[model samples]
Target: MHAIVLVGGKATRLWPRTRWQPKALVKIGHYSILEIIIRRLRDCGFDRITLCIAHLGDMIKDEFGDGRHLGVAVDYCAEERPLGTAAPLHLVPDWTSPAVVMNGDILTTIDFADLHRQHTTSGNLLTVAFHKSLLHAGVGVLRVRDGRVQQIWEKPNVEWNINAGIYVADPRVRDHIPRSDAADMPGLINALLADGQQVTGYGFSGQWYDIGTPFRYQKAMKEFLTHPDRYLRPDAPSNGNGRRNEVALEPDGDRLSVADLSPWS
Candidate 1:
């Protein structure tokens, strides 16, 4: 499967930690967040990958120039301006296959190949992966009727099936995005709905973490050291020396632009 990993967020929520490097380049263990994600994708049978990058994109392009080092072919699409989440899809030249698009900061063990397989069979234009999460209301919430308070619940734990920031989209989905403005996946989903295209939600449980906040980042770091096996496959490709095999990039100079480089051939 050809996968597009969105790595271009400003990540203002991550602040100084991402001040110098894009969140995808932030290192949690022996590898950067993007590196581990790509490695996991490779393990799940994805061989062609493209990164949609912006903030500190040049560094990302330099670090994984051709993706050969990771046992897959890699290409890059740089967003000259922030394109939200889905707009960057327009920047890519073309990836004809049904593809899974993911947020750069997410670390998950979902089998992307399987996700694509399901998308093909569902007859849906879009299939989104969702994970359940509980959030505290923090303050008492009340039900009101005619200036009278119905029962009050204090700090309820709300259960929700949150978007995992991962999706399998048909190539034609891009046709819905206009080249003029920034668009996000949510907007794209809504557009698909308005156009009468079918969309689906795939819910599953797994070791998934969105390293968007410092607390979450710290938690991932701790959990990974304690249970690396949960996230990484023992059979995943690796160099005998105990690290991943990687390729060196050509000497860097000027910054890159949208669709400037590809490894499709």
Candidate 2:
């Protein structure tokens, strides 16, 4: 199956550092976030990947060019403007098969192949990997008989679930995205749910982090560095220069728009 990686965010929250590089290029441990994600996709037997890039897109293109060196065939679709998560799929051609889509800035150990297989077997139009979190919930106070405190129980935090930014989508779902504007992924999923289209959620209990802000970025970097074996690739050295040593197929500033220098072959 093909994979689509969203590599185009302004990354304003990661300012000063991302002011020059795309968030995907941000290094965690020895590998750039992009490299780690791509390696994971490859590890799960995925190739023929498509990178939907916007800001600093060329830099991403230059870095991963064709993907052959990394044991995959990489292609790119450049968006002139920021298209929300689900819209870029419309810009890619011929990936008619079910595809895996993910945010470029995430670090996760979830099994991509399993997620894809599950999506197909369940016969859902879309399936999202989800995680659960608990927030502090106040205890319940009960006033009984004559306004006397009858019961006081510590409030338990409510359980909340969220999408993990990993998705499996049918090509037909492209019909829901508009030709332009900030058409988003969540809205599309909501539309599918409302229409009774098959949409599923897969619970994943794995290491996952959204590396969009400086704090998260630092956290991811520290985690990977301290536990390198958990995330490092076989070919990657432990000395931690893998990111800097990576071959640049293209390099462009994320916030500053630049011309596409990718070789058309």
Per-residue lDDT of model 2, residues 1-265, tens digit only: 7998888887989887888988888888668899988887887789778999999988888899989999999998988987889888888878788899888988876777778888888787888877544445455423255555553334434344557898989898887777767677898898898878868777665567888777888888887887765554533332321111112223222211011211221
RMSD of each: 14.3, 14.2
Give lDDT tens digits, candidate 1, residues 1-265.
7899999988888888899989999987887889888888888788989999999999999999999988999998989998899999987767787888999888766666666777788888788887644455677655566676654556655545668899988888888887899999999999998999878777555567889999999888876776666557735322221111122223133222112222221
TM, every model: 0.80, 0.80
List residue ranges in candidate 2 displaced over 4 A.
136-153, 233-265
Candidate lDDT scores, in order, read: 0.77, 0.74
lDDT of 2: 0.74
